[model samples]
Target: MHYAPTWAADGDTRRRPPLVGDEREILTSYLEWHRATFELKCSGLPADRLSEQSVPPSGMSLHGLIRHLAGVERWWFHIQFAGEKVPMLHYSDEDPDQDFDDLSGDPAQALALWREQCEHSRGIVAAAPSLDATGIHAASGDPVSLRRVLVHLIAEYAQHNGHADLLRERIDGATGS
Candidate 1:
């Protein structure tokens, strides 16, 4: 049975990124659009379906992607950008792929965490004086600008959205951007 995601935007609800806007507006809009797209792709499936590894030999699932994106948000925004001391999500150096590999939790909970991280990320961006605001890259010990992080995140979501699209299609033959 198909279940429409109550929280996520369908085609009608998802906002179109402004064709003309300030740099910050443009970037944030695109990021928000991509996030909604990811969520949209995950809509209309039961938890079992969401967590099912429909793509054979590939461990990716809509639920796993949600968990992975939550971890990405924490790693980039909370840890790197905001310099928050929050514990990493579904990760340890000993088990780097836990987010995608483990699918034992409620998909709702994972999506909730993903939403929380996204909100925090927006706050960090808002608090910054400009896109030039810098964060320390944990791995490189190098300065990374908010602009770079935003662009990188957009790319990350875009790449993952493609995966989401395929996974969604395979699970139920549903497809769209």
Candidate 2:
């Protein structure tokens, strides 16, 4: 009898994390997958839909998510990790939640910024000689390792991707990672 191969579901174009390899390679690959998955969840959405607070009583929108993620990339990778003296994005002491609450600008601009931050993050990760390389925690006077930051980032994206999935389904009838 003939049998069909069980593959990842249709439209799943992301690379599978290495079956066996360096720890850094596996972690980074998984992170890239999560990032792409987040983007995929937001795909094909118009700016209006992207900006909709589809899940009512929550101020979260896809546009806001994009801005939030971009800020997170900078916050973790550049400011905390690379020790770049750059200002934080979408945030001030008075409005800590602006990243998720403010959706007033062009969403395309937010997306572009997200993409740029992602690229910058990739560069920082690549340049590091070891995952053991440490960055300072701005809130505390302790060091954080690149490995920990990468894992945390992957988790962050995965959690937000779940929110994105729900938002996309509510906006349209599409679903899946």
Which segments of candidate 1 are over 4 A away from where they belong? Answer: 1-11
Cα error, residue 116 of model 1, in Å, equals 0.9
Summarize candidate 2's per-residue lDDT along 126-176 as a digit string, tens digits: 999999999999979699999989999999998999999888888998898
For model 1, state the Cα shift of residue 149 in Å: 0.6
The whole-model C-alpha lDDT of candidate 2 against the native structure comes to: 0.87
Which pairs of residues collide in model 1? none
Q: Give lDDT for model 1.
A: 0.87
lDDT of 1 by residue, 1-177 (tens): 122233343454667787677898889888988998898888778878889888988988899999999989899987888788888888788988787898999998888889999998988999999999998988798988999999999999999999999999999999887
Root-mean-square deviation per candidate: 5.4, 4.5
User: Each candidate: what lDDT?
Assistant: 0.87, 0.87
